[model samples]
Target: MSKHNVYKMSVASVYPLLVAKAEKKGRTKSEVDEIIRWLTGYSQEELEAQLKKQTDYENFFAEAPKLNPSRALIKGVICGVRVEDIEEPIMREIRYLDKLIDELAKGKAMDKILRK
Candidate 1:
């Protein structure tokens, strides 16, 4: 799929799947929320608003209060693509979230997942 198509996907559509991925491994939705907040700098209210608004991935990220400086530190393969090798900036952000969710599903410690 084209990067533009992925960018247009609704965050609401993906959020539940991310929660489920973590939940299956005994992780809480709040932890998923925390990871997202840590990466995007969204407040609890802003996050909730985005969830309710069903924002698109592009806008969800574009409007982020802050994209953590440390997100550049998230490096790994996700969906057969190295996170650090992604050429598109927005797509890289999406993969960063994907990688974090994958780590959360795999039971990676929160501090490390948050790049602390």
Candidate 2:
């Protein structure tokens, strides 16, 4: 899928897959949630609200309470592209989340995964 299609995809649709990705690797859903909250600055309640609203990723990041400035520290390739090298603002945020999820699934510790 093109980048635009990914941006338009609802978080609800994508969330389950994220959880499943972590779960398959023996990680818990809560870990995934933690990564998300850390990256997006979304409270647990607000994250659930967005999922229920079926918010697309573009709006999800767009409406995030605070996109953690530390997220810029996240680096690495996701889907064969280095996230830090992405020029588009929204796409960079999306890949930041993706990179975090990938790290979680790979058994990186919570503190390190959150860049804490």
Candidate 3:
């Protein structure tokens, strides 16, 4: 599938999966929210608004108030692709979020998950 198609995917569709991954590991929804906010700089209200709107990943990211600079430091393999090797900016951002969620699901410390 094309990157465009992936970008156009509804974040709402994936949100539950992320929540489930964390919950199954004894993490909370609020922790998932915190990871997202750390990555995208979205406040609780803004994040909830996006969730309620069922925003596509593209717009959810594009309209971000601020994407944290530390996101660039997130390095991992997601979907069999090394995030640092992704050439497209948008795809990299998407993978960065994926990686953060993966770390959260694995029970990494919140401080480490935030790349602090």
**Least accurate stretch of 10 residues (summed lDDT) in model 3?**
1-10
Candidate 2 lDDT over residue span 33-106, tens digit each = 98899988899999999999999999999999999989988999999999999999888998998899999999
Q: Evaluate residue 12 in candidate 2 and report its C-alpha lDDT on the 0 to 100 scale.
A: 93
For model 2, the superposed segments whose C-alpha errors exceed 4 Å read 1-3
Ranking by TM-score: 1, 2, 3
In the predicted model 3, the residue pairs found to clash are: none
Q: Show where candidate 1 strays beyond 4 Å.
A: 1-3
lDDT (CA) for every model shown? Answer: 0.95, 0.92, 0.90
- C-alpha lDDT (0 to 100) for residue 49 of candidate 1: 97
Candidate 1 residues 9-106, lDDT tens each? 99999999999999999999999999999999999999999989989999999999999999999999999999999998889999999999999999
Candidate 1 lDDT for residue 51: 88
Candidate ordering by lDDT (highest first): 1, 2, 3
Q: Put down candidate 3 lDDT per residue, 1-116, tens digits, no spaces.
A: 46678888888889999999999999999999999998889999999999899899999999999999988888889999999999888888889988999898898999999878
Name the runs in model 3 displaced over 4 angstroms.
Answer: 1-3
